[model samples]
Target: MMFEPTIWIGAILMGLSLGLLGSGGSILTVPLLVYIAHEPEKAAIAESLLIVGIVALTGSITQFLKRLVDFRLVVVFGLPSMLAAYFGAYLSQYVGAQVQMLIFASVMVLASGFMLRPISALPNSNNTPNSINSRVDDFTVLQYLLLIIAGIAVGTLAGLIGVGGGFLIVPALLFIAKATMRKAIATSLFIIAMQSFAGFMKYTYLQSTQELSLNVPLIILVTVCAVFGVLLGGKVVNKLPQARLKQVFGGALIPLSAFILYNNV
Candidate 1:
């Protein structure tokens, strides 16, 4: 099938969003793959997993080199997420396209809500090790439970919708794990990488029964662009006004979500 130039534009923007925002860009992949690229919902979701996972893993590696990632948190949060994501991907075969789009649209709305929040309102994770240690001491059983639950939720969503779940995972890391913003971002990328891959593998296995196939060349093209975008984003992240960026991106989501819901409903 011939793809329009608009689809390529959307793919570039999707990667750019990942590079710039870290997490929000993957949300756009499903819509782009489905509507612009004209792929089936299930195939779009599955392809999104591969695209988001590759981009996220590249970002995570950059973060790791800078010592921003928390391996301990990755283990604590990622294990359950990986398992749940696989299950969710497997279960997705039973859901209809319209229903899946409805669910995905709802999630887009939720993610927009998170994105619209002023960054200033979030807790600063700039504490020194000694200070962070004290806060860590206050971590309780409830927080642990919340972390596990959050992990499962993120994993399942990643599997079901083909998102990286970084929007949800970042907050959970900040609140439940008491990770600093840098740590949370870095760690969230790691978890997303794991969850997305697990989901993608499940989807691949399930694809045996379906006649639909992924556009491997398109996937490669988008992945390459996204990786470049991540590098570019990393370089300019400090110069950009993050709050304004978030606000704009968040505002854009509202209309997109409504559009999806309108079409599906």
Candidate 2:
């Protein structure tokens, strides 16, 4: 749609990956913008943020409509993340581009590790505590504090990397909130959308002095592909063995992060 074969090809691939895998599309977008579109690293980061925000937000709507989103957890996580995202954006403006890229790559590597980590066996599928006297059955104030801390840390990373923070957010929901995988994914999307908006605003303020141009055709093409991708992903996610999928996804990321970090540095 933008009449740039490479960019469109990249967008299509990104969309397809997002639909097929839940979280790898943003990782693909950065290299595509840099190598294929020949965009500068900084511009590519900004553009990727916009693209990821739009794509995730669109995917989020489906989860929301299905009543899968947990707003309580979203608020608990999203609030701190929003504040940290602004801080991350401010830091990005002053930091060198290569430093930012290196940081982004490091985060991806860590996130991949998290994705590959084994999930513990839950006592129950509902994730609701069965007894008041049970050690794991209580929600203490400290747990909430830990959640907020995790939110801020991951949000800072998201703002730095232009990702939606799902890589961190999903596991966090599972570990801290004790949410089911399905609920964690749905809640993470809502938080990502919120955090992305905050991060986008933060970056927008930093780049306010520059005249920006939107590649309108690019947006349409990406959005269309993203819509289809989300639907397709939703259809297939239930069929896959999540543990295997996560490991395969992590395997893909390690090398990519290394290459991007090396090239950018």
TM-score of each: 0.93, 0.85
Per-residue lDDT tens digits for candidate 2, residues 1-265, read: 2567767766765655454444666666667666676666666666676777777777767778877677778778888997887777777877777887888788788868876776444322243544212232355788788889999997887677677677777777777777766667767766777776777777777775543344545556655665666666766766866667667877888988989878986
lDDT tens string, model 1, 51-152?
989888888888899887787777778989999999899888888878889999999999899889987776654544743432434668887788889999
Off by over 4 Å in 2: 1-22, 119-138, 210-216
lDDT of each: 0.82, 0.70
| Candidate 2 local Cα displacement, residue 260, angstroms | 0.7
